[model samples]
Target: MMLIEETTVADDALPVEAFKAHLRLGSGFGQDTVQEPVLRSFLRAAMSAIEARTGKVLMQRSFSLSLTFWRDAEAQPLPVAPVTEVTRVALVARDGVQTDVAEATYWLERDSQHPKVRAARACLPQVPTAGAVLIAFDAGYSAAWDGLPSDLQQAVLMLAAHFYEYRDDTGLSAGCMPFGVSSMIERYKILRLGMGAGQ
Candidate 1:
């Protein structure tokens, strides 16, 4: 199984100016813009870190999940949370032929923690032997930073600021997450009950 990011969040979607404000940096003299690239990188890294730790996608983007077979024919849980829509489902043959599944054949089952693609009838379209099924979907809390929950938005900015403050510190340990960031994202983490781990 392979999960591919079909579309990434646009650079403008990131809160560059907001981050500058958070950092209390000066503006209008063109000095703040000099560190824009570095700030952007930190924000991206912080977002990735937060997303990795939590099941949530803070920014809207497209994703494609390709698998040889469905874990369940009637319902297949998506990889991420807050899915806005399921764009397409296709079966690709080993010979590279593509067959698109009609929208009426399936629907999205929305959940905060686990969104799923469910067959409208009894089961999802079958995957050809030696072929794969591709599911394309969009997932995120919102397309803009302001649309996110206040806690998540603050977590991102906090983590990004942590990165910025420690940028030149060679002694920093790897995977160093601040306590505040973790506290903010704690509720967003996906918890397992040790049952039906197969899913």
Candidate 2:
């Protein structure tokens, strides 16, 4: 499942109009004809709306902006991040279980400076899971955990499903995926058959 939401930063809080004008002038978009003020207002409103929905405030200097209009309709453009990075997923066995029926832990690593993780962390306790934990990160990270027992696999799957659903709805991109729960269950089943294969 995926969560969908908007994120924005206030226009009044940044010199967006000036920045836009600078871009137009540099790009030869006719500095005299550029409506910087109107563009600024539109950007401010759009950014504010996104921020209000997703609780993310983007730094103006960190991104470039663009706008387009067609006939009587116009689209509000979003800032694009230049870097592409992988997201890490990890499963930790809760009680040192080595089989498929053990409890586990799930963690997501994203930029430590992201406000979404901070907000999510504050609301973590309200998630209703007793042993669940959330962690924030600044760079690419990965982890390996001991295998979990069968009964716990279902619970972890439920949590992973919820996360997948939420992220799918939200526009943010991350590479994390649920692995341990099902993999361990399959491994345990094979082991019971006296097979020596492991995933």
Candidate 3:
């Protein structure tokens, strides 16, 4: 299965002012405006890192999951969490033709941790050969930054500040997340228990 991001978070949705405030940049000095581009980059990077570590989309956006066959026809689990809506389901043919699935055949199971697509009746439609099925859905906390959890907001601020402070540090390893951010986001991490592992 492949998950494709259709629409990304809007630039305006980012908390730029909040990030600047966290870095203690004063408005009167004009430094904030001078470093706006750097701040924006750091904010984006921090948001991405946090999302990757926690498996939670910080802002609302659209995504498409494509697959050759359903993992489970009755209830296919979506990869991302906090899915707000499933916009459409389509069947792509070998010749590149696409057909939309009927709305009556399926429904979204809205559990914040494990949103899924469940068959409305007994079973779902057969998966076509030589093509793919695409499920389009929206996932995230909310469209506004204020909708983010307080801890996540704090984590973003902390991480962004770290990035800003270490802007020229090439010694840092790839995907080098700070300890404070990790600890702050620990509770949001998804822990999957294997069979009988929960016992």
Candidate 4:
């Protein structure tokens, strides 16, 4: 299985000013925007780390997941949540033939932790022999940074600050995430399922 991000978070959607304030950096300076590029890179890095640890997208964006088979035939769980929509599902054969799955046959089962693409009836559409199933969807909290949950928003700021503070620390401490940041995101992390979860 492979998952690809289809869209990038827009620069304006990022909380650059908020992050600078969080870091207590001087404002109103002529070069205030000079450090923006570096700051944005750290923010992106922090967001990526947080998202990976939580299995939740903080910034709204599109994703495409491709799989050879389902872990469950009736309900295929999405990797991230909360999924806003399932844009498309299709089968692509090795010979390059494509078949779109009818939207009527499946529904998006919304869940905070385990959103899924569920068959409306008995089972989902079949994966063509020697072909792969492609699922395209949008996931995340919101398009704007302020739309994120308060805890999550604070967590991002805290983590980003940690990263900024340790920019020169190439030792083990540089790689360590603060306990508070971990605790803040712990509840958002997806719980592991049983052995049957594997395909």
Model 2 vs truth, CA RMSD: 22.5
C-alpha-based local distance difference test score of model 4: 0.90
lDDT of 2 by residue, 1-199 (tens): 1122222334454344343443343556567435555555544443333333322332322222211111111111122211122122122234432222111222222322221212222222222122222221222111111122323324233333334345445543453334543343332221112351210
Per-residue CA lDDT of candidate 1, range 80-147, in tens?
Answer: 88899999999999998989999999999998887889999989998999999999999999988899
Between candidates 1 and 2, name the one with more favorable lDDT: 1
Which regions in candidate 4 have their CA more than 4 angstroms from the true location?
A: 193-199
lDDT of each: 0.90, 0.29, 0.86, 0.90
After superposition, which runs of candidate 1 have C-alpha atoms over 4 Å from their true positions?
196-198
Tell me the lDDT of model 1 at 106: 99
Model 4 lDDT per residue over 146-188, tens place: 8999999999889888888888877855367789999999999
Ranking by lDDT: 4, 1, 3, 2
Residue pairs of candidate 4 with colliding backbone atoms: none
TM-score of each: 0.94, 0.21, 0.93, 0.95
Models sorted by TM-score, best on top = 4, 1, 3, 2
lDDT assessment of candidate 1: 0.90
Per-residue C-alpha lDDT of model 3 across residues 18-90, encoded as one tens digit per residue: 9877878778865557877778888989988988887788889999999999877798888878899999999
